[model samples]
Target: MSETLTLPSHLRAVRAAIADALGIDETEAVPEATLLGDLGAESIDLLDILFRIERATQVKITVADMADLLQGGIPDEEFGDENEVVNDTGLTHLEKVLPQFDRSQLTEPLTADGVLGLFTVRNLTDLLTERAAAAGADAA
Candidate 1:
């Protein structure tokens, strides 16, 4: 049996925006899932996605917002070596950014590369949702 996923309106809109930006079908952009690995999104696609999302949702998103969301404002001191390996303290901060996934499941010697892999469709949805809510509140 196939189970259909019912995403919130904001999530659906965000997914559609990402898909449109990537020139892919909406079904391929799974909700609440990673964008890069799961949806074949390259670094070049991220800016396009952000632009499309802003146009579709009327919510401005910045790279700093994404960075803060993914890294939880974690300082650089948490990284150990030249590879930017995440130490335990860094992992703790990363957990705040990626509450959807279990940190225990992360590969050993978690690096900056691994953290980049954690960016998901849900993250985009959450960002848009929060921005929309804040805008609404401000207008009220």
Candidate 2:
């Protein structure tokens, strides 16, 4: 994670917030880095990061919002099978939205929790920027 100033302002703010939440160097919050897999961000850290993001961008995105966006309107029962494993339909949706995730790495069925590995910093930045723009539009 080399120090660089080439990132966009929103992305810079995201990286900074993530790094600050996780107690890591800002450079460690690379765009492609997975929040859970690469940076070891836990659920609590996510809350802290979101708080920081809201403070920085004035756009709030709750964890439930993230879950809904990830699900893409799929029902909770359909999103996960009876065994709580992600079904083929769920996998398809995940692959479509979370292209950063390597599905081949799964040696067994992917649980809902495993999907967190797909959430990269870039995804957060993109989602946040979209939400911010929508907020601005509403304000207008």
Candidate 3:
């Protein structure tokens, strides 16, 4: 018997948007996986993906939102030192925000740069879903 697909509607739409941004097949965009590592998305591709996601979901995702998520709700300046090295407290916050990644794989001296690697397809979907829900609530 052929099994019906059970992915959430928002997740499927987000996956398709990511696939289109990355120029990859939709089948390769797994929700639980990292976009940069698993899907071979470059840093430059992220802007395009974000634009596509916003258009597809009709949600306005701001740079501040991305920064807050990346910094675990902490201000960017507070998350690190002048050299951009993440302190212990920042590491703890990062662990909380990006639980999808293996913390053990992080470099000995973690920097803000490493956080970029933690963003996953699931994260994007979650952001879009949350924003869309909030927008719906505001409209209603």
Candidate 4:
């Protein structure tokens, strides 16, 4: 990463895994970079990256977990309008939960499918680290 990230070890592991999965140097995986878009990660890369994260951090995050984090448990109908455009409720929740979401950059009519584009390196790291913390707390 060009900007040095003072992240916890587990969070650093997320970036490392992403870089490895994409066959790029570790420094390329900036936190703000969107894995699917900026890093050119496909669906298969995500699975490999997640598995690597699990091995390194002991936090097993499935694809469904990432989807759930993005959707915030909002039902499909509630997340989007009848036209399948992201509704106000979805927008509000997304902004509140994801620090990376910049409302200004978004054009209108953001479809429900487009939300996945918001998934960044920081987002994935936060998800795995949060789950790892929760698992530790549960064990304690």
Candidate 5:
């Protein structure tokens, strides 16, 4: 089997953390799901989720960003409701913007150690955001 490096990049690691925390399958972990009410995730679980997401995507998602995402942030009218776009922060849907990802590559596991290695709960989002901005610049 191909290693994780060959798979398409995704937020799978992030979802996996949420799933693990909620004791559910990855499929049930949707973007719109509330971490507390829907996934039964406690505040600490949310921090873990952010950490995993950063590890999985190599993107830093800030506390403000987390708040926005958790709250169903303001959407950009350009992408329509089908795509979750953050208008306030100028963030577009990754899937919409970067369509080249191979879904298979998204299967890699985001282990606890790996997630922790990437970020701490408090800094995960902000670090992820900074990384993403830098990456977007390189891609452009």
Candidate 6:
């Protein structure tokens, strides 16, 4: 089942994550704020934002996934090869699963269509929550 996100709470975190990535104040971050113009993010900065979002949300998104997000939300089937590994950096026991695509390009600015074209941020958050719950259930 899909989990719903508390938009207020999620937005706050998302904004914070982006701010942290840009090394700026959260007050400067806003939904309408352009990562490039407002946040002073360049292409590399954008990739950093994506990684920050993944770290904050725990959803493993690939560069291909980001490109798909640029187009619109990706379907589960097109979510890329489920068999792919997710780089788990700094893990103790579990092997780290690296992202499928190149990390360098993640920071490029996504146009309105690019950003909105991807799955809604809420959907990405829910996907992460669902995975965590599934992992917890398996542990139990």
* Predicted structure with the largest TM-score when compared to the true one: 2
Which segments of candidate 4 are over 4 A away from where they belong? 1-7
Per-residue lDDT of 23 in model 6? 87
Q: Sort all candidates by TM-score, best to worst.
A: 2, 4, 1, 3, 6, 5
What's each prediction's TM-score?
0.84, 0.91, 0.84, 0.91, 0.42, 0.44
lDDT (tens digit, per residue) of candidate 3 on 59-108 = 88764576678786676678888888887778788778776755577657
* Tens-place lDDT digits, model 2, residues 1-140: 53556778789889989989999998889889989889999999999999999999899988777787678899979998988899878888988887676567779999888776678899899889999999999999
Candidate 5 structure quality by residue, lDDT tens digits, 1-140: 63334423453465566677667886676654545655676667766766767667767655556444323343435322334422322223322322332224544532222222222222332335556778899989
Residue 108 displacement in candidate 1 (angstroms): 3.4
Candidate scoring better on lDDT of 2 and 3: 2
> Where does model 3 exceed 4 Å of error?
1-5
Which consecutive 10 residues in model 1 have the weakest lDDT in total?
Answer: 1-10
Clashing pairs in 2: none
| Candidate 6 C-alpha error for residue 131, in Å | 10
Model 4 pairs whose backbones collide: 1-27
| Backbone steric clashes in candidate 5, count | 11
Taking the candidates one at a time, how many backbone clashes does each contain?
A: 0, 0, 0, 1, 11, 12
Estimate, for each residue in 13-37, the C-alpha lDDT of model 6 and write its tens digit.
5666667888887667755555555
lDDT of 4 by residue, 50-133 (tens): 999999988899989988988899999999989889888898888987898967778777887778878999899889879988
